[model samples]
Target: KTPVATLALAAETLENKHIVEKPDKLATYAGIVKYQSDHLSKQIEKLLRFAHTESGRLHLAKTTVDMHELIRESITHLMPLIQQKNATLQLNLNAAKSCMLADRDYMIIMITNLIENAIKYSKEPVIIITTINTPEHFILSITDNGIGIEKRHIKKLFRKFYRIRNNEEYVAKGFGIGLTIVRKIVSAHTGKIYVESVPAKGSTFTVELPGLK
Candidate 1:
C-alpha cells in the first residue's frame, strides 16, 4: 500500500473502540501512525533533495567535520529503528585521521541512509561500521549480512528509482532514491563510493573521501 493509504488505514484502526480499550493494541496502531508519518516525511525530504540535485541548487557548506563524531550522531538518530529491528552496530573507528572538509548535515544523511539500508535489507542485522584513514583518503564502510546485491545490479544501484528486485525472500521498500541521494552527496564532497557483495551473502558499501590530515 502507498504511505497515504497506510496512514489512513492505521488512523481508521485507531478509531476502533476495542483497540482503544486495549493499551497494547492502541500502542501498536499508534506506532503505525507515527511510523507512516515519519516515512512520508522522509520521502518528501528525498524528493526535495532530488529536485535540488537536478536543478543544481544543492550546495555544500564545507567545514572541518569529524567523521567519527558524525557516525555516532547518525547511529543515535537511528537508534529507534535499530532497537525495533533488533540490530547491532559494531564500530571499529580506529581512524587516526577523522576530520574532513564537508557539509555536516549531508554527511549525516549519507551515513544514516547507508546504515538504515543495512538494517532494513537484512534478516540478521549485525552491521559493522568501520572507518580507516589512509594517507590519502578516509574510508567509511558499512557492512551487513543482508540479501546481497547481484553483480548485474551493482552498477545501477546509484541510479534514481533503481532497486534490487531479484530476491523474492526479501522485498525492499522505499522510493529507491536513497542511494541516489547518497551518491549525489558523496560526489558533492568529491568522494567515491564502492560496493562489494556476494548474492545471498552480504554487501559492504565503502565511501572514500579526502581526509584532513
Candidate 2:
C-alpha cells in the first residue's frame, strides 16, 4: 500500500508540467519513487523467500538501520488502522538514538507487524513505543492498553498460524503469521523477544538486539 501510494504520488508529480518549475520537489519525488520501487521489490522477494513450502532458513543483508526512522515509518504506515481504532500513539525515542547492523526491510516489517497486532486487540487503544539503548543491548518496547493475553496463551504467541480467541469467533482478521515472521527475523539477527501481560489490563512486547559494535 505504501509503495502504491508513493508510486502514485510520483506519477502525479511527473505528470504535472508545473512541477518542472520546482526542480527540487521533482528530484525529491523521483528519489521517493526509486526507493519505493526497491521497497516493493524487497517485499515480493520476502514473500517468495518465506512463503514457499520448500523454503529454508532466511537470508539477510546487513546494513545500518536507523531505529527511530524505522519506527516512525511503521507508525506512519499504520495511520489508517490507528484512526479506525481511535487509538493514540505516544512515542518516546529521545534516548533511542540507536542503529542496528541488520536488514532494513526485515526491521520495518517486524516493527509494523508488531504495532499492527497491538492495534487489533487494544481495549482502550493507547499504544506507547519506547526504546532504550544500553551498553549491553538496544531495546524497543511496544506497550498497548489492550485486552491482555492469558497466561496460558503467551508462550504460544510466536508460533505460526497462532491466533488468540476465547471462543468460536476470531478476534481479528489475520493469517497469524505476522509474529512468526517477526520472531524469525529477530532470531536471524541474534536478538531476543519478551512478552508481559495481565488479563484485562494490557500487553507489552520488548525486543532486545545486541548493541552495534
Candidate 3:
C-alpha cells in the first residue's frame, strides 16, 4: 500500500497548492489525504507490534475465544470491500467451535490481514472463508478466485517489502506490506501460515494456531 501512500501524499501536496485558487477541491483532496493517513496508521501499528515482539515486551493475555465468532466479526469489518468488488464471501465453518488462548488484538490483526489480502487479489465472483478443526491446531483458510501468485513468488510472499513482480495491474496500488504483517502477527501467536497458489487458478492462505480447550 506504499503506492497508495505516495499517491495520497502527492494528493495532499496538490491540495495545498489549490487551497487559494480552488478551495472547492479541498473535499476531494481531504478524501485522498485521509486514505493515505489511515494506511500509514496501520503500518505504524504493525511496526509498534513488531518492536514489542522483538523486545519481548509483547505479552499474550490468554483467553478462550470462539473461532467462528471471530471470523464472522472479521468478515463484518471487511464486508464493504467485498461488496465493492461485487464478490460474494461465504463462511463454511465447521460445526465445532474451538476455544484457543491468545491475545485478542493480535488475532484480529491476523484475521483482518488474511481477509484483506484475499479480497485484494481476487478477481472471481466469490471468495470463501472456512475453518477446520484438527487435534493439534485450528486451521483457518481464506481462498480467493483472483489473480494467483506464481510458484516462484510464493517463497518471498512473507518477506517484508517483498512483492510479486510483473503484475502491474495489481502492483500499481499496493505497497505489499499486508502479508508481512500477517506473518509476524501469526508467528507472535505461536502459529504457522501456509500458502498454495497457481497463476490463474487462485490462491489459498491457511493459518494454523494451537487449539486449546
Candidate 4:
C-alpha cells in the first residue's frame, strides 16, 4: 500500500483499539500525531520548493531588501528555540541599512535554516549572526558554539539526506534536508556557501552573494 494509506490505516487502528482511551493517553497520542504531521508537512514543502527551484519555476521578486532588518526578523521567528536552549542570540548587523536585490522569501528561508542549525547543535549557549558588505559581495554569517563538524563531513553537508554520525550527544531533530534546501536556495540566487569549523570549537556558515548598489 502507499505510504499515506499505511498511515491512515495505522491511525484507524489506533483509534479502533482504544489505546488512547484515557484523556492523558489520548492527548499524548494526539501530540505525537501532530508532531508527525508537522514534520511531514515540512518535508513536503521542502520537496516542492526544491522541485520548483530545479525546474526554474520558483518566482523571484527582485527588490531591494534591507539585510539587517531581514536578519532581525528571521531571528525573531526563531527566538523561541534560542531561548529554549538558553542560548544567546547576538546580531552584529552592520549591513542593516544595506539593501540587496533578491527574493524576500528565499532570503528568509536561507537565514532561517542557518540560524536554526546554529541553535540546534550549539552547546556553548551563544550564537552570533552578522552581515558584512564587501566591495563586490554581500556576506551573511551565522556562527554557533555547537558540536562543530569534522572536515570530512563539511563536504557532504549540502548533499540531500547527508548527516554527520555524531554520537547521540550531538544529534539534533531533523531529517538532514535543511542544509540541502539552503544550498539550493543560495545557488538559485547566484550565491555560495562557506563553512569553517573545528570539532568541539563550533562552526561558522557564511553565505556570499553578489551585492547590489
TM-score for each of the candidates: 0.94, 0.75, 0.77, 0.78
Kindly indicate the candidate among 1 and 3 with the higher TM-score.
1
| Candidate 4 RMSD computed on C-alpha atoms after optimal superposition onto the true structure | 4.8
Evaluated at residue 82, the lDDT of candidate 2 is: 76
* Model 1 worst lDDT run, 10 consecutive residues: 164-173
Instruction: Give the per-residue lDDT of model 1 (tens digit) for 121-148.
Output: 9987999999998899999999999999
* Winner by TM-score: 1
The order of the candidates by TM-score, greatest first, is: 1, 4, 3, 2
Predicted structure with the largest lDDT when compared to the true one:
1
The local distance difference test score of model 3 is 0.74
Least accurate 10 contiguous residues by lDDT in model 4: 1-10
The global C-alpha lDDT for each of the candidates, from Candidate 1 onward, is 0.90, 0.81, 0.74, 0.79
Candidate 3 lDDT by residue in tens digits, 102-171: 7777788789888877777666547788888887889998888878888889999988668775557554
lDDT of 2 at 35: 64
Error of 3 at 54 (Å): 4.2
* TM-score for candidate 2: 0.75
Per residue, candidate 4 scores C-alpha lDDT tens digits across 1-213 of 333454565487567556656776666556555545654665587777877776765577888887777888887776656665788987787763368899988888888888988987977568898888888888888999888999989999998778887786867666678898898878878899999999988999999988886
